[model samples]
Target: MDLSGGTLEIVVSAVVISISVPGNILLIYCTRRCIDEQLRTSFTLIFSLAWTNLIYNLVVNILKIVYASNVELDSAVCKVLMFTAVFTTSLAIWFTLYIALLFCSKLCRVVHPPVEAACKNYQKFHMVLVFTLWVAGVAVCCPVLLYTRRIEKLNTENETYQQFSSLIYTECKTEYRNDLIEILYGKIFLGAINLLPLLIMLLTGFRIVYLLWEHRKATYGGIWIGGDASELEVVRACKIILLLIFVITSFCVSYFSLVYCLKNFKSCYFAPPVLTVLSSGYSSVSPYLLMLINYKVIVRMRCFCCKDEKKLVTVSAIAPVSPYA
Candidate 1:
């Protein structure tokens, strides 16, 4: 069914906000409650990712929904909004890349167990790395803040401007004022920021999957035998990382599709809705992917829910030996 731009944007934003906000919050809460220092350090990228997506959904998507109905906004406000959205989106992608790299590093440990100790040493520096990435995202997108200007055009003879409302309409667009600069920004700068992370993600993702498969084939034989808690932990961690890769893969597909549409069908009626879905889909779906990582959370809660029963199980697992006379 065909839907209006405003309707489509609002629907997509509403769905994203509903899932991202609470899911990120729960992720943050659970991460904080975690007692293992190593595990918490491992989640540094994840926690940052959840935080970035939460802000993007709450601030950018909400504003997009409000502005969808052709409300006039000041040029400065428009630039700030657009810049923030782009910055957060880039930040989110970079964080996902970082996570992919982290998992790949962990997967390497399965092949070279001695490397595990070295990997653990770097865990202490993850927060610093995450902070640097946040700074880098802002710096990379700084051109957006400087070059964007909201322009309003009359819809008289030429139909370059889409109908936003019954009256005047404005759009935030890059105005580098130089053909060379605009071309560089569009082709080089934009491609680096948007496509580079995606390439890294795909590379790291495939390596991670391959390493995981090889590890499983050599170790587990595709079945979990009893009394191997470490094996269980490795399986759970791999599942969570796989879920994250799925989210990134989806974003890569959606984003490139939208980019292709913009280049070829700039004036298509479906562009706006496609843009809306492309921008918001990953943020929306990733949180639920995170919610699925609650396997650890469930196990933690189970320990509290039936402590005595668990203790009994542990005790009974050991067979009693009779003394001979």
Candidate 2:
């Protein structure tokens, strides 16, 4: 097959898959070995996001490959793939915000949680919170699947855009069935899936930072650092790294989402392959950055697998007898 688009899709998707698969697995391992329960929920959210990103990258890339190779799927399969790809990415970002909030709560102690700290039952509350997030992501995705369709078309020179599966069918000249209700449905997806949640995440991060400063904590660095005061130096280091990564990742995601939405209105807009690779690269970089800059995490890592060495000399001496005895 003379496949230019397929090549581009594979190149971009390959980068996404390669980075995400191992990155998530390693992040899961790191989380498992961590002993500090203080940031457990935050790390759990990161872990969940990393793993979900892996799944999304794998599924979407495989479909990209299969579809690029001219493989066809029924409406049901198309619906499932689109729903999953869109939903899971949203889930990853939403849960990541929850991660940020969990940390901010610790730093600012803003909303006192119903459960006590790091108790066995704490996980119960955690599950409820995470599940609600998952449900919300899926619910938002429903509109995307309803509005979108897997389409095939031929441009000049018989060049095909098969994997350009999603299209605004309202203006499609061919006899492919288009529904007015679905167009309205597209607006729902455009707002809910892409715009509203994104705005919420951005605002949540800002509110968290503001609250931290307002409370007179997180002055030099981030919201909170609860351990040894002397360790505050290391904590400050970690905070700088984390905040920088968070800011960068947020910008990339926002930029990509804005472009994706604006481009969707027309037949085809800019699909810069390089930008796709850059967006996909974020997943791989995030976890390593965490491990690299987090001093407490590193200390805990050493504790998990290593024994303390405090070698010393011994001297023997006789004890004096008690006068009464």
Candidate 3:
């Protein structure tokens, strides 16, 4: 079915707010509750991304909803809303890149962490890094605030609205200025958000793949039984990171496609199937990926729902203890 822009906006808003808000809240709680410090650090990064997405989605979609409802805003509100959305979207891109890096480090097994003496230093570095990225996002989106302008309407009712659509100019600046700045922004996004991270993610993944291959070929008898499983686990994690990159980058590319398409071909705004699916697919699909990859979250979800059921199974079944548990 062809959904109107207003309908689409509301649907997207509902889905993102419902998913990201609660999902990220739970993620933050889980990260804080993790007993393993290293595991907690990884979960913390994921939680940070989740938090960013939640806030970004809520703010952006609210503005979108208001605009879709034909609620014109003053300059100050426009500036703040636009800047917040752009800044947080930038934050989301870099946060995903950071996650890809973390996955790579794990795969390399070169993540030989520092001694206990340097734990504070290590955490401090992470804090500084995340702060730097947030600051950079703010800086990148600063120009957005300048685009703020009061949008006025002559006739905003029924037949008058349809006739006056051409007269309405809510955009802050001339098309030329917006285009030039957005072009620069586009290049930066293509490089920083898509190209750079994709390269790093791919490079690290294949390096780990070669390393795993070398380790597996060493023809030790008993090593295959134990070492093989560990290697396989690492490979599995590598696959997850690779899949993560695909899902993450696919969203970036899809939006870029929409931007370019909208720029060159305005007629597509009538809710082309490709455009509609691409637009909706990002928020619709991302939560599934995040939940799937977070092994702990998966465990938590089951335990969250069926804590009593688990006990019943343990008690009812015959207790057969091997040397292991």
Candidate 4:
């Protein structure tokens, strides 16, 4: 039995969506629990990230599965799916950039404590920023809806179709009515979407690592130096920041692989589904990492497992502690 590209895509996309959607929802729930119980608003970017991932999995991957399964769709439906998929993908990229920026700002505070107040005040505007990012996503994807149309062509290459003489195959494709618009949208707009945000994430992630290294070296050269609680807190924060940076780096590398394959080897029969898996690699994986960073999820899981424990012992042993504490 030959496993075709479309079959592989359907299987991979279905698995990815099934896993990522629930993981992102759980991350959101964990983030909310942290906020309500621990009074930590730092979950803002994390929540936004999870939400965007959820949307991408729900919209993009699900549609990919449907398309892979050869479901018939009208031009309108195809346009909507393509536009939504692109919009959510763009939103995910922007949210990652926002997270990198936020972490960078937090590290800046470690260098100059005086900026802490300004950072907190700035964070108060995160909601407005998120809303603006969503608007930008919609604007960028508008062309996809406008230019996309369903096209049908004869499957002349198919040996099975030889007996039938002709078989029609349909696909949703962008129609560039204007050459200038095509060049601008393809070379400039889509180029930025693919490269710019990832570059920002890369630069910020490396800068963060450098700053953390310097801080760690200045505080603890080689051996264990007994430091105050704030110093310890900074170390923990640096570790978490490093973990998230690693996640971002993975996302960049995987997405770059997909883009590179599509651009250079478009004719490869096995590449598309493999690239789709790579494309969703980060979204499916990052939520669990973020949940681990939240700490609340671990505590909640422990509480559920030890529900029969004495209340006094539980309170004394596992009482919620401030992240900085």
Candidate 5:
């Protein structure tokens, strides 16, 4: 059956909320329960990411539902939705990049000694960096508050313009003050904020692969690296980070590509569902991937599945070491 755009949007929003809400909440609970004293920085980043995703799902998707329901909302609500969307998206990207960087630092300390000195104090500044990223996201997204509003139809005789206006009237859309401001904020600034991190993640992923290959080669030789257990944990963490990077990159690339196609080729009627999936797909899926970083969570999940209280107790006493820890 063919669905209208509004019906599809609501359906997509409902699906995203269903997955993202519980997934992010469980991730937050598990991360908090297993926060490592020595690796507080890493735990904090994960916690922030879960919280951001949860907030994004709640604010953006719910508002999207309201909009799709043909309910009239104030311009303030539109502004809030637009602002939250951009702010949360920026925060998620930065948080994921920070986690990847943390893993990269740990791996580099072992695999590449030349960069060890620079990365030594990285953990100490994580809190400062987190604060800065949040503040910067706010500053960068403030323009949304100014430029975004509910689109209303103009008194025009043009059929095409009327059709376009009606299509977007129920949506929160941005109308910048001028061409320059639009180009600057819409194209250049926002593009850099998202694109730069992906570039860094790509470089970090390459470095991680190189380090893993080197470590494996060294192990096959007569060389014995220190702290096999700890190194193994770091290696595991690197693998998770690589996977996380891959997920984020895939979602981002697909989302941007669809956005570009829709902007340039207005007849792309299939964009809505695909765009919705790309937009919220990562938030729904990334938390479960992150749960793999904490072994205690896995063991607890296994115990729960087996319905064995004694196994739970035993798992609790085992003092499982998280890679982040």
Candidate 6:
């Protein structure tokens, strides 16, 4: 049995929504509650990324479901969907890169006291930086609003339409005013959102790895005595950051490769479902990974569970003390 393109899209969208919605909501709730005076700037970035992912999943996937059902939607719906997809994805990528840079700065601070002093000053401007990213994303993706239009299938019996229908949504498509505009916009959009950020992440990830290796060698050689718990936590967080870089990089590479194939070779029938997975995969997955290294969130959850367990123990003749407490 073979599924149509619409069916494939609906299945993929549904799965992404199921995972992304709850994960992002919980991530947002946890990060919001954990924010404080000292960690305000850092957790703010996490909160923003979670918020962006949740919005993307809700807007894009819901619209995709409606479109895939073959319901006749207005051209504006297509424009909103495309614009949201591009804008949200760009914001998510830049936010993740921001996080990697934050970790790199911390590691540099450890290696050079002057760098740490500079980072302390830089922290004051983080909110402004975040605002700028949002504005920049809007500027880059605004053109998409004008170019995207509803794709109409006028003749159902057309051989070309039947052949390529499995690979594209019959309701929405993007068309620039001219080839030059399309080429120019494509290069700038791809470079800014995907290629350049990916390159920076890779470089930052390498710097983090080298710093950790150096720290470990020093600790083992007895140059640094009795590693502090905070230092250990930083090491753990850096490792998680490396994992995140890997996840985002893999998805980025897969998405662009499939997109290239679809554009160049018109017979890429399997591209739709795979492209859907690649497009939303990182957004759906990264929140949970961030939660793993969030000590405050972990502690709060444990305390909540312990309280529930204590409530159950009240019915017993003798209550057991919780290890968590």
TM-score for each prediction? Answer: 0.80, 0.65, 0.70, 0.81, 0.86, 0.87
* Residue 107, model 3: Cα distance from true site in angstroms: 1.1
Best by lDDT: 5
In terms of TM-score, which candidate is strongest?
Answer: 6
What lDDT does each candidate get? 0.64, 0.53, 0.54, 0.65, 0.76, 0.74
Descending-TM-score candidate ranking:
6, 5, 4, 1, 3, 2
Query: What is the per-residue lDDT of model 4 for residues 1-325, given as tens digits with 9 covering 90 to 100?
Result: 1155566667888888888998888788767665642334457767878888888788777777776555666788778777876777677777777766765665566644563354234444666787788888888889889998877744677653332211111366677888899889955787688578878877887887887777677666754353544444444555665666566667666766665445644334555566666667778887876665534555654555587877523322443443332
Candidate 3 per-residue lDDT, tens place, 103-126, comes to: 565555522323443323365577
Cα TM-score of candidate 2: 0.65
Error of 1 at 185 (Å): 3.1
Q: What is the lDDT of residue 217 in candidate 2?
A: 56
Question: How close to the true structure is residue 163 of candidate 6, measured as C-alpha lDDT?
Answer: 50
lDDT score at residue 154, model 3, on the 0-100 scale: 38
Which runs of model 3 end up more than 4 angstroms from their true locations?
Answer: 1-3, 110-121, 150-195, 202-234, 261-267, 271-284, 291-296, 307-325
Clashes of 2: 0
- Candidate 5 residues lying further than 4 Å off, grouped into runs, are 1-4, 112-124, 154-170, 225-227, 264-268, 300-308, 311-324
| Model 3 C-alpha RMSD to native | 6.5
Residue 5 alpha-carbon offset, candidate 4, angstroms: 1.8
Name the weakest run of 10 consecutive residues (lDDT summed) in model 3: 316-325
lDDT (Cα, 0-100) at 30 in candidate 5: 71
RMSD in order of candidates: 7.1, 10.1, 6.5, 4.5, 3.5, 5.6
Cα lDDT of model 6 by residue, 1-325, tens digit: 1365667778998999999999888888877876766666668888889999998999988887776566678888889988998899888889999988886776655544362333334546888998898899899899889899987666666675455454235557788888888777865555567778988999999999998888877778787643555555566677888998999899987777666645643234455566778888998999988886557765554554576665432311222211110
Candidate 2: tens digits of C-alpha lDDT, residues 107-129: 44332224554534365588688
Residues 187-250 of candidate 5 have per-residue lDDT tens digits of 8899899989988989989989998888887777768454456577778778988988998899
